[model samples]
Target: MKLKSGLMGTIAALVMGLGAAQAEGVKVGMITTLSGGGAGLGVDTRDGFLLALKQAGDAGSTVDLVIEDDQQKPDIAVQIADKMIQSDKVDMLTGIVWSNLAMAVVPSATAQGKFYLSTNAAPSQLAGAGCNARYFSVSYQNDNLHEAAGAYAKGAGIGKVFIMAPNYPAGQDSLAGFKRFYDGALAGEVYTQLGQTDYAAEIAQIRASGAEAVFFFLPGGMGIAFMKQYAASGVGIPLIGPAFSLSQDILPAVGDSALGIKNTSSWSPDLHNAANKAFVAGFQAEYGRLPSLYAAQAYDTANLLLSAMAKSDVADADAFRAALAAADFASVRGKFRFGPNQHPVQDIYVREVVKVDGVLTNAIVGTAMTDRADAYADQCKM
Candidate 1:
């Protein structure tokens, strides 16, 4: 009889514990492009979140990360989000890289009262009035990075710039961002369809336009194609862009052609910080290749989550959210803080492609930009 009563007590305690967690643990849904060309960004994000989880360890977090791939499709993203919110019952959702995808996914998540932390992708709509307390951007606004590129181009005194990007929201935003800081004459601003493989028409137009420099924002496979075409065209003009195009993945593909090209970025493998040094060493040891900004950002996002979890009861979602808002995480980026809008206010750097030990890669040129504030910070009334 005593043994039976003891077993019954244990069962009761277990049920109560679960009930308490149901009332509190901040379950999260993570959505990203886990397959196809943009997979690198997702891989990096996953790794970062994992790193944070490991570091946070078993605090009070019965925290569950429900991972799903959008497959770079809007329909898949929405479907996955619905399953997470309704069936899986997640309290928060994060991670979407493409602006088009984020634009579609964010509204529903916010409307349903789930906090969304954007690991990447900054659509202008979120910044200008669509802002929400349920939403926070751990990355910059869509235009911030491109704006840095524009500022650098202006400072370099480039006479005329031929801007080319896909006719997507991000592409449009990038051109506007560049134009904001660049006071030079526009040779021509051409918009191509998303995933247009052949750049012959655009390249020919660029050459004929007689622009002194070219600015582009093509992440993943698109970037690889365009840069290769630019090199083949004998475009002598300086190739300057944001890291999205000329990143770690595209660097190997672009190879020698990208040598001397410049791109602005938040992180580079060559960064000298202890955390950065350790990360590059470990990533190289694991993947046998250098980590890109996508990888670094994902890594930081995970670390941020882990840090916040450690500071508060993961089961207590509200407390964890409060801790995250007061972000005191040790990011590989050294010190980064979340702005009112949940976007990070961090320094930006300019890196140039240089062959290091016979491998063509981006080398940190200099710090062209520094700790800059995003335009939408004040709007995040949180």
Candidate 2:
């Protein structure tokens, strides 16, 4: 009888331990553009996130990461989100790379009481009136980098600037953001089709506008296309854009044509921080390539998740949300915190593309804004 009682007690203890472990473990569903035009960005983001997870040693033990490629399609993203939420029962939904896809996934995921941590694609609506408690953006608002560019352009004494972006939510945000801080006269504002390759017409317009400088927010293949064409166009006017346009992932494709171009971002590989130095070194060693801003943000997002998991069990939604709000992770950006809207409030820096040992990359040139928060944070009711 005594032996049987001891055996029963041991069995009960084992079952309870298993239950506790299950409660602590989290299931994450990441839907991002993995194929097509923006695949490089998504691939870098995934690789960075996975690198962080591997460093944490909790990827398979404490976290189950399920990644799906949206192919930059909003409808497909929505379908994947629905599947993740209803079928896979993911504790979190993240990694939508495009603003339109984020708009389709984030709100719905948050509405269902699931946490959505954005690594990129922080649309204005989500930062403002549509903000939700369950949603947090590890990346800057879509307009933040452009606003920094505007600030830099204004400070550089640029009198007339030509600005252009893709005709999308983020693109509109970019132009509006640039206009907000730029005191310079507008030479021209053009909205090209998203994923546009040939910029011959836009380049001609920029040349004819008598602009002192060109500011653009084209990302992925569009930016690569524009930079290559602009270089060949023989336009002597200086070109400035957000870091997305001149990211490390795309800089090699743009080659020396991107040299001397300045862009604004929150994170750079050259940032003088212990965390950043380690990340850059590790990323280079692991991937044999320089990490882009997208990769940095995604890496930060994964670390943020691991930090929150250490603080609270995934089954406890409120506790998990509180833990995430604490922002208790060592960020690659060094000084990092969350705004009232749960978006990042951090410094934005101006980085100039330069060739380092025959490889194209960005080097920090100046600080554009210190501890900047998004303009829409005040509009968030939460």
Candidate 1's displacement at residue 209, Å, is 0.8
Off by over 4 Å in 1: 1-26, 51-63, 314-318, 378-382
* Candidate 1 local lDDT, 13-49, one digit each (tens): 6878755533334578999888987777777777656
Q: How well is each residue in 1-382 modelled by candidate 2, as lDDT tens digits?
A: 9569657856876878745644456889999888987999999989889889888874436778899999999999999999989988799988888998898889889999899999899999999999999999999999999999999999999999999999989999999899889988999999999888899999999989999999999899888898899989998999999999999878988888788989999999899999899899999999999999999999999999999988888777888899999999999999999999999999999999988989999999999999999999999997
Among all candidates shown, the one with the greatest TM-score = 2
lDDT of 2 at 113: 88
In the predicted model 2, the residue pairs found to clash are: none
Of the candidates shown, which would achieve the greatest lDDT relative to the real structure?
2
| Lowest lDDT block of 10, candidate 1 | 18-27
Computed on alpha carbons, the lDDT of every model, listed in order, comes to 0.79, 0.91
Per-candidate TM equals 0.89, 0.94
